[model samples]
Target: MSGHIAQDWEPVVIRKKGVAAGQRRDEKAVNEARRSGGPIETIKKFNAGSNKAATSTPGINTKKLDDETEELAHERVPTDLKKNIIQARTEKKLTQAQLAQLINEKPQVIQEYESGKAIPNQQIISKLERALGAKLRNKK
Candidate 1:
């Protein structure tokens, strides 16, 4: 009896320069576009157009806004409201995943609301109420 091992151990050829150069160019273009607050498509087009890196992407403003004039908007959803949402969803015998599908939202969104990690906007709240057949909003 003869024991024979079958194996194909061929050394792989690595062509780094071509692939690496392309990836580097793409990364550089994307970074430039992001820093300038320009659309990513602009980077793609710029890269497709020429080998030179663009100093500025036209039709994009790179000005910084003052914090005093910029108001950070946040919706205040009461903890009771979060409880209401969870209660209603449970009463309907629906999982957060199911509720998300019925309401056309991601499951993570439902989970976030239930866990009090997020306050959904008015539009989403309305959808949730309809799906769970419960009133989530407080009468004000």
Candidate 2:
């Protein structure tokens, strides 16, 4: 039985189509074109008609520009609000860090508010007003 089993068992060699011998046909063409300095067409082309002409120019009416500037001004903490905050905080004898702690905010937030760079937040402003005992909004 052992001699019969030895005769039946044989080594099998499995060969897989080894990685397509080298560079693929299309890749080789691209590489050759690069080496030869031939102009290869781009995959995407700019549509000349799709681009819109510049609407706003120096000679154009600036009402729209003024409206945009006003909108940007409204988005940030007002300069007067910042000044009021600084004055109130100073009058209360509190440092920026101390005022921030009192209002449950970070010192950087207080710094941003004082510098008029803070995005106006009603909740934070309310907290600041309460902490400083001052009105901080809509003061001309």
Candidate 3:
């Protein structure tokens, strides 16, 4: 209520020829892929904009940083996470197939996640957290 203009505001400045963050993904559903697992439909949906009519679109299966790329890598749980996943899955009184259906994924994804062989993204963790009514991942 001072002498300040009520409508006083600053406008976002956009520089020409500048690419904004997350612009790298153009409706590829990359976030979905990262969260939902590598489903064939998701792959097709992402690569619809094929410059040269792509033969196949790399989906979640191809994701993850290899040894060559160690800039920002994630470390999978040695045993505790595997146990936690298994325990949580059991506590829900749900089978792998049922859990997959609940999370919109294949049974194999659930198996892999519990086996500690694959990294689960936020969506999966969120589902697990809700189903178990507890946090599943311990982030550092």
TM-score of each: 0.47, 0.48, 0.42
Number of the top candidate by lDDT? 2
Better of 2 and 3 by lDDT: 2
- Predicted candidate 1 versus true structure: per-residue lDDT over 1-140, tens digit per residue: 59898899999999755645434457687798789887665343546667556655543544433324667777666798899998998899999999999999999999888887786688999999888888898998
The true-versus-predicted C-alpha distance at residue 102 of model 2, in Å, is 0.5
Local accuracy of candidate 3 as per-residue lDDT tens digits, 97-140: 88888778889988888877777577777876776676676776
Model 2 residue 95 CA deviation (Å) reads 0.2
Backbone collision tally, model 3: 0
After superposition, the stretches of candidate 3 with alpha carbons farther than 4 Å from their true spots are: 1-78
User: Can you write out model 2's per-residue Cα lDDT over 1-140, one digit (the tens) per residue?
Assistant: 55654457789999996646443346677688789898655355456566435553554567666656543345788888899999999999999999999999999999999898889899999999999998988744
- Record all residue pairs in model 1 with backbone atoms less than 3 Å apart, i.e. clashing: none
Candidate 1, residue 56: CA error in Å? 27
Provide the lDDT at 114 for model 1.
82
| Cα-based lDDT at residue 30, candidate 3 | 64
